[model samples]
Target: MLPLSPAPAWAVAGAARVRPGDAAWPSAARWQQLGEQVGGRLIRVQSPLVACRSEPASAACAQLFKAVKNPYFIGDDVALTQTLGWVDAWTSMPSAYAVAARHTSDVVAAVNFAREHRLRLVVKGGGHSYQGTSSAPDSLLVWTRAMNAITLHEAFVAEGCAGQAAPQRAVTVEAGAMWSQVYDAVTTQAGGYVQGGGCMTVGVAGLVQSGGFGSFSKRYGLASGSLLQAEVVTADGQVRIANACTNPELFWGLKGGGGGSLGVVIRLTLRVHELPEDFGAVNFNIKATSPAAFRRLIGRVLDFCSQALIDPHWGEQIRFRRDNTVQVSMVFQGLTRSEAVAVWQPLRDALAREPGDFVVDSSPLSIVSTSARDFWAPTLVKRVLGFIRRDERPGAPRTNVFWPGDQGQAGQVLHGFESAWLPAALLQPNRRDALGDALFAATRHWPVALHFNKGLAGAPAEAIAAARDTAMNPAVLDAFALAILGTQGQPGYPGVAGREPDVALARQQAQALGRAMAELRRLVPDAGAYVSESNYFQPDWQRAFWGANYPRLQAAKRRYDPDGLFFVHHGVGSEDWSADGFSPRT
Candidate 1:
């Protein structure tokens, strides 16, 4: 774990930003002029779910409720976000108006308008933010849903780096492009790989800026580390090119400094890699009969990870459940099916020796591998593999598909979410038993998932080196895995009658999730969390999210957006304003 510096007292309080009822708010003529500047793309935003509240028994209301279940549908809507809300935390709320940005010029116009008018500004692409950072009521929104475009280059170099940097195969992704679209274009069609978020509908710009991790991140490192250049519109409405050679400090801050902070990224260029030979997944479950057996099971699993699975070939998660079961949903790269099975043989044998204490729950261990290129091929996934769920709405693109495992997150209300990086030292022979005990105790409260790919330890030296340069907490470079505990309710938003979230149950589960993470904190008290996945109410957010890198990121934030024209909850320089981002401190 990295040591944290004291929180800075730099931000000063000031007056609130302008809102709907303010006398200085934009008039109808001003809005019309701005709309004309953007080619009439302005939108007066309102949630389509409002119909459900008005006509409870209408057929259209029923269809609308079912459509919210589709992530792509939610992403396409201008007013809705992928997550509905969090109990006593935040709910999805639409901005008063939005500029449906179709190009960089549109984004620039929106930024200028918001800054000049002192309007609360929000940016939304895929709208997958679990913390409700993308949606703000009574604000002006820069909606990038129409800006999605993907282009591949056989050899590309950042501007002003022709002599210093070598050309590499790369892909330029627009702010609104989803991982599903990028995967289809780069890997399925071009036969090359680009690291990105595992979820299909997550936006490229948001994920890259938030230190993205995918199933193959152990081999390729973070998606942000692969960023070569970005076209961004800053607070002053200047479209600047940021890369290793130009605006280098801003480039570093953009990589894992957390999205919607430094500037509005219009597009990004990321290096691509040669496709691996194979991609595969291994899944199974084990149930222990008693507490002692569960502890022993955890120990065996840790030993297996330390011995073999920690390497670059493996990734994904292992879940320790309160039901005395451990669920394995691990993925692998560059390995054939037989090779993957052989790798797990030792654990299988170890479990066989403990028949009296453990049982193979229902399904036996299943290992399957496929040609790497077929992993994201739309046709193959839809017809042959059947591992992904497609957006079945009429006229939806074939590439719009998501993993079945991610279905629970689409439009769901979060209860609580917390993450902590577990350093490799805990996996040592001397401390492994204590780690096992902590895992058991944590499961007594709520399920704990260890996401191996989210951390860089045990990865290739080059992968670790690349990740170290990013603004993500340096602790990730040494942590073997990221332990996460999260709870959520069904697919529903607040204020929707008959479809409202169960607040009582959500609060109850949230407390249990908090207790579960507290158990892990006892082992690594000062562990830094991944910025995009940490607690929404983190007290020392700057230290917890960026660690020693916070000061550097703050410097860049000051240089580019000194007046703080943009605001997201707990984002950089957010301390200068009220929680809603409408009022500055006095």
Candidate 2:
């Protein structure tokens, strides 16, 4: 790979920044304080137990805000007002109060309390779910980030003893454990590894729900497909287990179904594989000048990906991070750099020369990064690069949104949605500057990029079934298709999700891009399947992505979360938006 360079001349010159606007404050506080006067209950978590060898209450609410008592935060607690994550989420200001849950039992208690009291609740795992479904307007958030538990199973794939160990082995991890933590533990302790871990922090539960992606998926399978068992706390507040033995159908549904379905996953168990000593990592960043080269490059990369599926000795990832920049990163399980060159030579040769007015030196590259390729990819480069758009001058208003989540080992695409304000008034141009500043500020660590499967050609039928049916299922596809709109970033972008400071401008962009992408799909072909993280697929698209698992998954939803507590933002059960003050205006 070539040495990193400064932002290109065009990029530096054309810094088209997007910002957020001021927002109307939520009235939940009034409802909470006022409702408490009546027979109603508004749960305001105040920590009971202080482990500081001091105070006490037998039972305690989550102490997340208190636990995060950094001077950086002023008076606002969960309603954190100043942080970048907070600013990003078009939150009018920082959160004032945040609930903290210490364990799964606490999670269950929180859910039941909200259920019993009729309070709207949002579940937060790693704060990485960029869809803002992880957060909401004046709702009680069930924070699960504190329940960080991770266990790597030795019986699953004992090192130096694959055939000698138990037939099947796995790892048990709490839903809150970040992907980074999981990788650290497995690489060192358990001797196993994530499927295709990406470069970010993530919680397994949310990552799986979004039909996780990774470099390894090209060969082995998706992270969701690795599910063996899971401990879930359902709407009724009952902690249930979903797995092959307990609730096999539901377990299958949970595999690739979107998050917040069936229940809040408290724990996840995944099938583990023996660690390879010589996995491969290769990357090439290219800038194309002519349309011919761009088109040919895409075709060639896709061809390589198609071929890699047949050879376990192969893995390929091609990404067009920007209009001019494209990078193809590949991983090989047993193949060496020499063998990989031979396989990639055809694709390389195709891009050797330029057609007309050739200027930008567009090309592909490959290298061996890690000792054992392990789990790695170039998506992070694109994402991180794209994410570094804003300013750092402490005084500016932050990005209008926030989504917190991490990339799991199976090349999890970490997405954390933050809040951003979208005023009811449409003609507000005053917000553009602030919104732009916020977006730039909040995305320092984020990289807004798109990625897809590189190889899945000649694997076992069951493996293919898992990817198509479970991970890339219809319902999940809907969630992923919408994810593209978030390429600029996640929800809370005010202008996204059909809302905006300038409705007309927003509409124009949406329609234009929608038409353009549709045409592209017809030509070069858009990705048929998408991870649930950026799911934008509607019913038809969902059906197309899933093929045949809709009925089975619906049945599972009925059986497990019969009370309608478990649901996606626009899921089957959540169709009744009217009750929640939402209308189908558009």
Candidate 3:
């Protein structure tokens, strides 16, 4: 990639770097040379398309694309696209847009090119978005596959004493770094860690922006709730810190407003939790079907959460196994298995007393694993996806889509869910099962996972304890927040009356769903809906998952990104955003 020459890392990392030797600043010749010479070593996965390139019209674009290899470069492609896992959708964009960025200057150059050309910009790392937001047609995407740096300072780990969880050092990460990287860095490097926060492969920028939820969430808080600071690149081209002291409002917006609607985020600093010196856990299972069993277990699932234990350690999720059995998973955060057992013993006996007696068939099941990874190897999914192909897939049901960063809902998913304890008022229980069915149908093509965090139930609600349940980040995909929208209060289902299914039923349903969620704040008293998967909800989803923070998020958007350049569906879709701000051409 170099022009028969490569520069040293010092030359690249120096405080001031200028394109040398009269080489084209962003040319294939100079970019490749600079990329190769950049000192920070990286293991890249190149885009498959890079191998089949038309010689760059310009030596600059050509050399720049050539220097990085597919495996070394992460691109947008079938092997990289999640869910459908087909090449057609994958091939539309360079699959595997991974680049080994040596320093900030490189990113600056790439970003400038994208802006000059006015191309849709998608920043990808693990390429795990549910809606394929990281990839788009003809998009000038920056795959942060190489900026996987994590600097952990253990001084932030929180030691829980006297019911108060304290803080420790911080972990600063490049946008490309995966949650798994941060987890490992903090857990192994600091000798302690935060148990649950997000999916292992998710990139930090998007997750934190969308108010990430996780296993340790119930005990400590949501991913964004742990955010200490961030280094964000504004649309106008500036890398500024957004945290408590610097642009605090912007800091708050960055933490929970959801991502993509905003500009590129380069780095993030988050607070980590200190695990008990002897941290350990156990899991239990039961055939989760049959109405009575479902009601009993589902009820206690909330009660167990609502009822404060001697120590705060109770969690639950009812998963419908491919085998048709519902896996009632009980996660407890404790120092020792013995200690965990003491807390879970009652939960186990109670769940055993009932079951998943769902409309679907059922069989009791049980398995205990130490970590969520032992139970599910999310990383292995990538390996399994290689067998799939483009021609082998089906087309989309609808061409249009939404990502729920709307009406201020973004911050909840990104920050508020973890910031404070939402009262039971935020959730309405009776309509939940219906929403589950809706979501199950919506994502029937892909795996549909529903968590057990109920904001409606008191005491130990699921939202209070289900941290580190790294299954889904709905905000990354759809523009809707599921339960928080209006459907909760709609007529029919539970306390409501009837649902007209035919004529423009989609819109009606949307409105109804929006209405229900808007009513949730009344139920929890001071609590807001604990937003988890925002794909099904948004700031406009009044009938869905409503909360108290939506207005503040709206106000912030008005003050910043008023032009709507950084706006997304519900996240920053302030009522004031101009309709002409964006075009649907992309």
Q: Which stretches of candidate 2 lie over 4 Å from their true place?
A: 1-98, 156-167, 196-199, 286-289, 296-316, 320-326, 353-366, 373-455, 460-462, 465-486, 489-509, 521-531, 535-547, 579-586
lDDT of 3 at 24: 23
What are the Cα lDDT values of the candidates?
A: 0.88, 0.46, 0.42
Top lDDT prediction, candidate number? 1
Pairs with backbone N, CA or C atoms under 3 Å apart (clashes), candidate 1 = 13-585, 14-584, 14-585, 17-582
Local lDDT at 540 for model 1: 79
- Per-residue CA lDDT of model 2 for 1-586, tens digit only, reads 1122232232324322111121332356643543343224234543211131132221221232232322112112333221112222232221123346666666776676555544456666655543345545435566666567777665554233445435476778887666655765675455576663443344567877656755556456678877777888887888887765576676777777667866888888787777776666556665556545554444444444444434345444444433544555545665666766677666555555544422333333345434352332223342363321212236622321111222111111112221111221111245333422322222232222323332344444555666664634433222111213232322121312222234344344444444434433332233344434333323343443343564565566667765455434644334423223122211
lDDT of 1: 0.88
Candidate 3: worst 10 consecutive residues by lDDT?
A: 410-419
Would you estimate the TM-scores of all the predictions? 0.97, 0.63, 0.57
lDDT of 1 by residue, 1-586 (tens): 2343332343343545898888999999999999999999999998876656777667887787788789999999999998888888888888999999998999999999998898999999999998899999999999998888999998899999999998999999999999999999999888999999888889999999999999989999999999999999999999999999999999999999999998899999999998998999998898898988998899999999899978899999999999999999999998888999899888887787879998874344378777888887655544454677788889999889888888788878899999999999999999998899899999999999999999888889988988899999899999999999999887776667788889899889999998988899899888888878878887778878889998788778888988888889988788777899887764
RMSD of each candidate relative to the true structure: 2.1, 15.6, 14.6
TM-score winner between 1 and 3, please give it: 1
Model 3 per-residue lDDT tens digits across residues 1-586: 0011222232234212112232322445533553554443222334333333433244543443332212212222322432211111122234222334546665555555445433334566655453345555433455566677888775643222223434556778888765655665666445546433434545667777767655444455456666766776665556667766566677777665656655667788776555544423333444545434443444454455434431235444444332333444445554455665555567666554543353322222232234432222222332253211111124521111111111111101111111113323222356444434433332222222334322113212333333212111212121111132221111111111122112244345444433333333333223223333443323333212233344555555555544333433344442232222224211
